[model samples]
Target: MAMNFFDQFDIPYILGTPLVIPALLFPVLMCLTTNRFLKNRHMTIQSWLLNKTTKQLLEPINTIGHKWASMFLTLFLMLILLNTLGLLPYTFTPTTQLSMNMAFAIPAWLMTILVGLRNQPTSSLGHLLPEGTPTPLIPMLVLIETVSLLIRPIALGVRLTANLTAGHLLMQLISTAVLTIMSSMTTTAMMALITLMLLTGLEMAVALIQAYVFVLLLTLYLQENI
Candidate 1:
């Protein structure tokens, strides 16, 4: 019962053996390149989508920051895969975990900060204080700005974790309800089953949107620095 309740969020194991790393890497590894060209229709479609998304994401970023294009695209694909795969039966979604989200968030956030500081120290520090501030409110505004700046990664991680967690929890509750009432309340259960199916479709869209948003935010951060 406990396993059924918490299985969506918890790290899943097979035969009592943990497989966290492999689960996380499976999506990424699936996209690994081969020497031969990808000639299949689906592979070609994927490549086309990748190309289009790359252009859209990099459009906002400056040429100087364009070097991170591959990283951004790969992260986007990995995230989408992870989120989508987790919707399947008896699978784990690492992005649903706050710790895992933070692991990705913090480093990416820090890299942008470091880039800003390294390439343009004055401009980076200048972000803490806006121009033409009144004397009395200077310290207060600076503190507020600094706190906001520092909280980006936390916001990023929590946003991803909360969104995924809520969606999965809702799906689980609806699914369980459907099962519990199916035998006794056939019509009502059928309605619920329809709702669940619709919600599943919505969740799949959310999965893709969240992945794009994550990487897009990262690009925006990098845009500020570069």
Candidate 2:
């Protein structure tokens, strides 16, 4: 029963090995391989989306960090694909797993910190204590800020994992209830079914928004450093 309820978040295995690599690669492999003068509707829509999203995401970023734009865009694409694809029947949502989210969060967070330290050591370290901090309160404030700084990656991973997991669990519970009561309470089952449909739509939007938020937060962190 436990397995049945949470199995959607589990990493699937093909024979012996986990299937995460292939799942992650799927979005990357789906992108256009070559540029052509002529484009189909699918290609045209894809290009338009790419351009619009890139502009929107990069507008807040500074010129120095523009080089990382491709990396950020690729990560966002992977996240959105994984999230939305998992909504389909018989699929797993990787972001629902804390470990996977942490894996992405830690490295990205660490990279931004490293950039700040390398580019402007004094300014980066200066963030530990705000200007005009009272003498006695300085230590306490610094301690608080340090802890907060260290918690950023944890917050990022937990935010993604918690949001996705909560949505999936709610959907599962609603569907289960709908199934359980369908034979006896037809009207109630219909209501539950409608709610489930609405919730699914909301989850789709959450998936996209979370992907954007993840990349946007990373960009914000980079902006602080650059």
Best by lDDT: 2
Clashing pairs in 2: none
| Candidate lDDT values, in order | 0.88, 0.90
Q: Count clashing residue pairs per candidate.
A: 0, 0
- Could you list the CA RMSD of all candidates, in the order they appear? 1.8, 1.8
Q: Model 2, range 1-226, lDDT digits (tens) per residue?
A: 7669887678999899787777777786777654567689977998899989988888888999999989999889989998887798977777888998999999999999999999998999899999998999999999999999999999999999999998999899999999999999999999999999999999999999999999999999888888
TM-score of each: 0.94, 0.93
* Tens-place lDDT digits, model 1, residues 1-226: 7467676677867888876788787875776653237588777887799889999999999999989998898888888888888888867888898898899899999999999999998988898999999999999999999999999999999989888888988889998999999999999999999999999999999999999999999999998887
Which residue segments of model 2 deviate by more than 4 Å? 1-4, 32-38
